[model samples]
Structure formats: structure tokens, C-alpha cells
Target: MYSGLMSTPERLIESTRELLWERGYVGTSPKAIQQHAGAGQGSMYHHFTGKPDLALAAIRRTAEQMRATAEAVLGGTGPAYARIEAYVLRERDVLKGCPVGRLTMDPDVIADDELRAPVTETLDWLRERLAAIVEEGCAQGEFTPGLDPQQVASTVVATVQGGYVLARSAGSPAAFDTAVRGLLALLAAARTPASAPAAS
Candidate 1:
């Protein structure tokens, strides 16, 4: 029953990714995926061993795409602080929340190691990448000394994830904007150096 630009396997993966994003692992079903992909049960079974197997494939693909997107901004040319700021200020789907992070809230997915590995690894990679940048900024005096890179990285991640929650709760992006703005102000203030008095 699969006939489209994408092959049966590709359609299954792509459909699973969207369904997982829109409806977490627990909510997504094999029938729903088959329907979304316009594939029949036989086509789905031919491509994947089962729902979990297909879901893992979808989760991995989503995580990879997510990482690539983050790397585009974080790895761009600029001062470390600038890179971090750009990442923080990067445009996002405020209400939809993070794909990987959202998976963490899914009890079924989190309970299954195979399903959770990609999500956990992706987030860890992001945190470590951010920590590396923060450490570089501190070394370059872009930030005040004694600031912990890991702590700052974790805070940045938390702020973004928390912003999504806040935005969703309020039914608007205002809360998200407010959190980001406040964080940026703090970061800016932290980087400001105290000036010496003019010569008498």
C-alpha cells in the first residue's frame, strides 16, 4: 500500500518521526503510523520488526536532525559568547517543545533503553558542546573567571526547555521571550568588565 516519492521504509520513518513529535511514543500506534505513511500493515512489517523498532529509527533520525540544526548555530564563526547567544536566541517552535526533550517525558520511551539512548545521547552531546564553548569563553576572558562551564551549559539547556513549558502553559510565546531576554541580560552583565578611574 506504499506508493509515493519516498520508499516504503523512508515513508515509515518520516511518518513515525512526525507522529512521535506530535504524539509521544505512548500515544503513537502502529496503525496510526501506517495510516499517516499511507502504507499497509504488510509494508510496515516488511520495513520494521515492530512498533518499537520503527520508533527507534524515527527517534534516531529526529535526534540527528536536531543535532545538525544546533551545530549549525553553535559551531558558527563568532566569539564563544556570541555563539552561545545566537543559540539561545535561535528561532524555535515555542509551543511544540523539544523533540528529544519531549521524549524524556514519555514514560514508555524513557523506560525502554533502546528508545531512550538517542535522546539521552543527543542532549548529553549538546550539553557537553555548550560546556566546551563556555569553557573557551572563560579562558578568553569573554566571561568572568570562576564561572562553571557545565553549570552554565546546563542552565542554558534548562532555560530553553523550561521556556517551552512556560510558553505552552500560557498559550503564548511571551513567557519564553521573557526567560530568554532575562538570561541574555544576565549573560551580558556578567561579561562586562569594571572600568578603572581616569588618571587624576
Candidate 2:
């Protein structure tokens, strides 16, 4: 059985994504990428001018993947809250942080707009999409009339991103879980009638 050949550029981009995830932008090197991808220096050079060029490609690919994931989670059947819960509760390596979120902390990656554009666009789009769903929920009477869709959407994203940062700093996944639980609780509270007294 043949494992089908991968072009040098494709291998390099895939390897770069892994390296970026594992070690970050500055931590990853061209040599390391070549070695990991099983491509020669010339092969890499033939396709990319340098690390930045390759990183751009890798970031774009990662962004596309993130968008697809969001669309799949937020654009499907079920209520907005349930779909959002599915998005957050779906299996993930919370300890590793979001691929898109991880890029935000990389100094080199964030410093270059060309490199960071995809990350920014991806996160912004996700938030907007979620906000639209929340707005829809409000209109459908699934959520409180006073609920602010934009605020809730931003909070949802913030909780996840901030949770990752906290998890990495604390060296445990507890922070991430707490964040998710807290967000869900807030959403649940919002679903109750305004006249209902808060649980003691």
C-alpha cells in the first residue's frame, strides 16, 4: 500500500502547523520544520522564501479549519444554547488551548498583520456567528428579552480564550472547566423569567 506522496510545500505547511502548536512561532525553526516534514532544505526553499512565508500559509490553513468548525457547530439543528453548549463541550485538548488562541500569544505571529490577519478574522467571525445565534434565540423567546447578544458572544469567546491562558498558567485544566461551567450557568440564568428570584 502506498501512502500517497505529499508535495514538499504541503508537508512543510503541515509540519509548521504542528510545530507552531507545540512550540509556538519563535520556538519553531525552519530547520526543525524541514526535519519534521522529511523535506530537504532546498525543497523547502523552493516553495517558500522563508519562515514567514511558510507561516502565513500555515496560519491561513489553520484559520480555515477553525471557521469550518464554528460553522459546523453554530449553523446546525437544535436551539442556540444547546448548539453553543455542544460547541464548547465537544471533545478538545483544552490544555493545549485553541489553535487560534495559541497564536495570539506568539509575539512574532501577532506582530505581523499578514500572519495575524487570519487569526483575527477567524475569532471575529466566530464571535459574530455566535452573536447572531444568540440574537435569534432572544427573538424566538428562548432567551431573555434583555439579553445582549453581542455581550454574551464576547463573554463566551473570552471565557474560552481566558480559560486557556489560565489553564496553561496553572498547569491544569480546572480553570477551563470552571470557565465553561460559569458561562453555561450564566446562560441558564438568562433563560429564566425576569420575575423569577435568583436561586439562593
Candidate 3:
């Protein structure tokens, strides 16, 4: 799934990332990675110490990509609620599920501290970033006072991850859309009235 121009190491990482997302850690074998990357076993070994090392690189790459994508929307100019909406409604492969979230379900990945670190860190960063936006929203009079930013952020993350599970189970994106719609509705309900004071 890579071009000839890509370096062997780059190809290996990219291939592993896709395989891990699709098949989880247990299913992704070194042979499969080499074959997918069109690299020889020698090339794979030359770049990485072993599967764990290669998997960590792939996981880190995926996590970095996820954060970059989220930051693009969350960091954009707009009301906090609007930015959150953009994040929740952002296009995704609902059926394939979250790349990082899937790792949390993989036994091998979770069992390995090094492999799991990126996944855990990525999710934690997401919650914190979202919590910051929520706190900003409250400050800007966009959301009602007394809303806990951290709680709200966790709910948002839960909804998206849960939505992916629901969508995958139903074999339809409708489940995901419904979950997002419900989240938006709740967020809308939490908005402060136009006449309300910012501090109120």
C-alpha cells in the first residue's frame, strides 16, 4: 500500500499501522507486515529491533496523526462549542473504529507498557485539550456555568468511542451519527442564554 519512493522503514511503519488498526496486535505478524510493506524480512529487522519496536513506532505515528487532526479543528478560530462540534462531527471511518481506541482493546498492546504509552497518552491529551475548550466555552458565556470541564470532556470522548463501537456492531454509520447528534443536543442545551452575563 506504499509507493516505490517511500523508504523501507517508512513503508514498514505505515503497513504496521494499518494492520494494527484492522487486525489488532495479535493478528499483525511480522510476515504480514513485511509483505504489506513489500519489504524483505531483512529490511524490517535492519530498521527495528523486533515487532514490538516496530509496533511502537507505528502506534506513535498513528497517535501523532490523531492529535494533529484533532488540534486542527480544536485550535481553529471559533466558539468553543462550534470547535467541539467540528471535532465530534469530523469525518471518520466509523466501521474501522478509532486507531488509538482500538489499541486499548488489544491485549498484547495493553500488556506492553511501551506500546500502550502512546495510546494512553493520546487519549489523555485529547481529554485535556477538550477540557480546555470546554472551560474556555464557559468563560466566554457559550456554555452554562457550573459545568465541569473535565467531566464534559470525558463524556465527549466516551460518546465518540462508544459511537464507533455502536456503528461497527450495527454495520452502519447511522449509529455513530445518532450518538453525535445526541451529544450536540446536550451541548446545545448547556449553552448560556444570550441575555445571561458571562460570569453567570
Error of 2 at 51 (Å): 1.0
lDDT of 2 by residue, 58-79 (tens): 9999999988987887889788
Which candidate has the top score in TM-score?
Answer: 3
lDDT winner among the candidates? 3
On the 0 to 100 scale, the lDDT of residue 130 in model 1 is 96
Candidate 1 C-alpha lDDT tens digits along 1-200: 44566698999998999999898887899999999998899999997999999999999999999999999999976778788889878999888888888899999999999899999999999999999998988887878888899998998899988998899999898899899888877776667364212348
* TM-score of each prediction: 0.93, 0.91, 0.96
Candidate 3 residue lDDT tens string, 88-141:
999999999999999999999999999999999999999999999999989988
Runs of candidate 2 with Cα error greater than 4 angstroms are 1-4, 192-200
Evaluated against the true structure, the overall lDDT of model 3 is 0.94
| Clashing pairs counted in every model | 0, 0, 0
- Candidate 1 clashing pairs, residues 3+ apart or interchain: none
Ranking 1 against 3 by lDDT, winner: 3
